[model samples]
Target: MLRIIGFLLFASFFSLKGQNVDFEYIDKVYVPTIKSVTFHPQGMGIAAPVSDVEGNIPLLLTFDELTNDVKRFSYKLIHCDFDWRPSELMEMEYINGYPEDNIQQYSFSSKTTLPYVHYELTLPNRGTRWTKSGNYLLIVYEDETEKFPVITKRFVVVNNLVQIEPRLVIPANASLYRTHQELDFVVNHPKLLIRQPAQEIKASVVQNGQWKNAVTGISPFSFRNQQIIFDYQGKIVFPGGKEFRPLDLRTLWQRTGQMADLIRTRTSTEVILFKDKLRGEEPYFQNRDINGRFFIETQDQNNQLAADYAQVVFNLYTVEPIYDKDVFLLGSFNDWSPSPEYRMIFSPEEKGYILKKPMKQGFYDYAFATRAKKEEKLDFMETEGSWYETENEYQIFIYYRPFGARYDEVIGYQVFNSKR
Candidate 1:
């Protein structure tokens, strides 16, 4: 009886673990030790993890494991709906070649106190290729009987069946003209028979590749002569948050302007930045930034294996701690997620919020944001003010799924910038 009960319990554990995955828009790290997960098109260090369906443009996937022992890892792709839910199509409908393949590339860290292993893989190799054009969730898991999930990243595959013309404009509304930017666009599906566009078509607008706050389920305003118009003046608006704060950790030997101290120990290095003051009320000034992006690099070593990890300490000085809302650090390094893992702790002694996390050697752009309890929406107004002059990237994705379709097809895609 004891043996049977133990076996049943073990089976139940796997069943539950497999059922509770929060398949969402942002990158997810199931294992705590996995750090610095990045997925972008090859050669483009800071770009959306999007690729053309026929370009054979492989994406670069890389991450580091804190443990010393190298482990077997494999990846599989799952088709996702426009809202990021798993689609009805089976795995074979979207992916060609083997369903899962072993990750054959990895290297151990060198010349660093914190021992780790770096893994890099160019996607769409001989092992696997994609056949559909839509949102996909790439899940990396252990190549074992249990198939434990290690990390998951979101990306898009566009078929380019339709052409999109998108542009950014200053909101005509006097109230929002200076603080918000508006988007106007048209989708020309000359090749596609887009009937019932208001009911059959939906679109999503993302700011800087951040899907967490992306505006989804928007339908076209009008359809005429195979052209779809999206003219939601005030409805299609985004807060023009100030430029991202820059952190230059490219070289630890020489401190940067905001860097307060660099502490080197026998095992690891600590990069501390001088306390940051709240800038919500300050005037907007032109500042150089990567629009909340990061690129890994080690100036001294010049390779992934030689790039060491560091404990980055962030100190935000606030006059009074926000008693009602919680603050978190947002950056491309962490998929701009406002999760508890990036949550800052309030230190009454310092009268500010603080957080520390492990980061690979790189130049990073980040900003502090706040959110209310039990809310997923983040507020940057308390920490960083909004300005129409802020530079930002906009991604417009158009999905089409007629009656009885199994999945949403990304027929049109375009990128727009607010700088101009």
Candidate 2:
């Protein structure tokens, strides 16, 4: 009797364990995962495949209790801004293997453990037209009778092309070895061509070495035409008075060859901000109003310094004396950090904050920020590098059809222009 009773208890425990492990939750439903993501030859387009295996995008999901009731499953595509904020692009939805309206509905059975479903959608043809380019999240929600699970992933789109012709300039009486170089260009897109009138167009030069300063101007080329010409001047001056020779230009350009290609494909108007400030008597500041200035420079195609650095001077304001205050010049230049490399200091005689560190030639976005809890403030007063709100150009591209289809091979490409 004792042996039989012990055996029965052991069997009961085993059975309970099996049942508990098999239980499921609605949130645990398997999400159709996109495995390998790739782009065509020039990284001009994007592609991804969904599959279940190692070396693939993994979808680990669980579902609630099983039932034979669910007959089918479907999906919907939503477009969002660079920050994943919902935008006007959501009106467009394209799904594979289903009617447009029927795409959001799915048929499934509760008893089915693993059902096979494959769907693909292509974005409309607009080359580098996304107003902003950066990181974007794609959310895929499963359709079920009850609330379904959601899967999210990230992808990048870029538009860095410059439509207007760029010109090179060398300042007269400037030392070839010691003086900074500059490049200027204009955006000639017609007013009717832009989606937003408030958007500002920006021009930047690429160079081999670091740029010491940069500047840009925009105005109506003529009073009557309503047409505007943008002038971009960039300069690169070696720090500590060390002259940059022509040979150095060759090596630098070769190392940065991919820059042009990246600009062409991923250019967008997405603006990121960085800010910093310095007070009187601080290490890097000058006076109370005239703060330190900042700028960027880059290389051109001929292995010579292409343009002068774009310059940005920060304006400092008088504030109540506070001790141990900290300020930073934050932006894409210093990896968007408030570190010693990008710190700003005050100069009492000069009445401003100063940036003593020399920056390499390139386009940069930066702003001012303070550390004191009471003094901490976001400074929009002094603009550095390039302002984000300026009108910029973008290109969009749409690649359609499955990867293996012979006739469907990358069948579509288009370009759209957005201003603001």
Candidate 3:
């Protein structure tokens, strides 16, 4: 009787874990059970990807579950085009091995108040590999049917065959001089002959390694001497957001960088961060920043796989809440997309906004932002200041879809920094 009850409870949990996944976005976590999800090129930090196509480098996928017991999870890959849409190829055409595989790597957190399991998997494992170079979506599901996925994230598989020359500088327009930076680039395809370069070539530009505001479907302004040049003044301008605020939660024994206080109890530990204020009117102070990217690291544990979790409390200072706006704590730690989970609530008693969230032990960079009611745009300048001289990273991607081809192929990629 006890065995049957245990089996039923296991089945019930798996049923709840099966949630529909949408592939339209870049980083998405479907199930509420999952937390602290990260996917990137192994040892390359968060913004860089393994660019080699010969299987010399592999990608890493990691996540944690709130439950104490371990669970079975499987993952599959979906090939996408340069525009992040599904490609025109079949599963067998892109994947050299099986389409789906199990996640065999995981471990439980050690010497921590929060009891949970951390799972890590590598892409192009022994049973799975990619045959093409382009965009990809890693879909993680709880069952073999794969009817619903618990998490989905986008990754790049690059085969750098073409050279790209990129430049970052102040914008030519005087109006945007104090707030924006400009990007210029040239794509040189010496080995591959692209007929009708204007119609076949597509260019995309991303700021701070984020896809929310990436400029895509751009054509080159000039084509000369086997070089496609993109020097548009108005189209390539990006807002230079101020330096990101850092928070350190790598240890619990003593307060670390930017930590206001640390509270410990029998069940869990909470780290309260110092109150932050609006920087809209502040001058542009040059400080070291990662261009809005974060990496997971821990000093308490020997490795990140053994790191523990902590409940982090973030405080924002304000005399009173804005009448028609809502504030959010945004950063790469939350995929730079502010959902309701990261929304800040006004504390009338404290006269500030407070957001308490569970986070892994690591160094995180974040910013405060505001959005008006029923609005889709987030106003970073309302909280974190924007300046033209602020250092930022820009990445340029060149794609080609020939007249006979059915998929968009990445022909060139280049990264540059402004005032680095």
Model 2 ranges with Cα > 4 A deviation: 1-85, 91-162, 165-185, 190-227, 231-322, 327-372, 375-420
Task: State model 3's lDDT.
Answer: 0.80
Q: Which stretches of candidate 3 lie over 4 Å from their true place?
A: 1-23, 144-146, 303-305
After superposition, candidate 1 runs with Cα above 4 Å error: 1-25
Q: Write the per-residue lDDT of candidate 3 for residues 91-185, one digit (tens) a residue.
A: 76788888788899989877678777899998778899888877777888887355567888877776776789888767898988899888888
Go through the candidates in order and give the C-alpha RMSD of each one to the true structure.
Answer: 5.6, 22.3, 7.6
Candidate 1, poorest ten consecutive residues by summed lDDT:
16-25
Candidate 2 lDDT, 1-420, residue by residue in tens? 999987986675455223323212111223323211111212222122111112122221112212234323332233333223333322212122221122222233211122212233232112111223322333344444653434333333333322344443453324442222333334444432333312332222212111112121122232113333433222311111111111011112233321222111121211111223332222221111101212222344332122211123333433432246666665423323355655666766645565544223343333455566455343322222222122222222211122232211111112221121
Model 1, span 82-154: residue lDDT tens: 9887777666677788757888899999877788888987778887888888998888887656777788899
- From the highest lDDT down, the ranking of the candidates is 1, 3, 2
Q: Which residue window of length 10 is worst by lDDT in model 2?
A: 240-249
Clashes of 3: 0
Best by the lDDT measure: 1
- In model 3, residue pairs whose N, Cα or C atoms come closer than 3 Å (at least 3 residues apart or on different chains), thus clashing, are none
Question: Against the true structure, what is each candidate's TM-score?
Answer: 0.91, 0.24, 0.92
Instruction: Assess each prediction's global lDDT (C-alpha) against the native.
Output: 0.84, 0.29, 0.80
Q: How close is candidate 3 to the true structure, as a TM-score?
A: 0.92
Best by TM-score: 3
RMSD of 2: 22.3
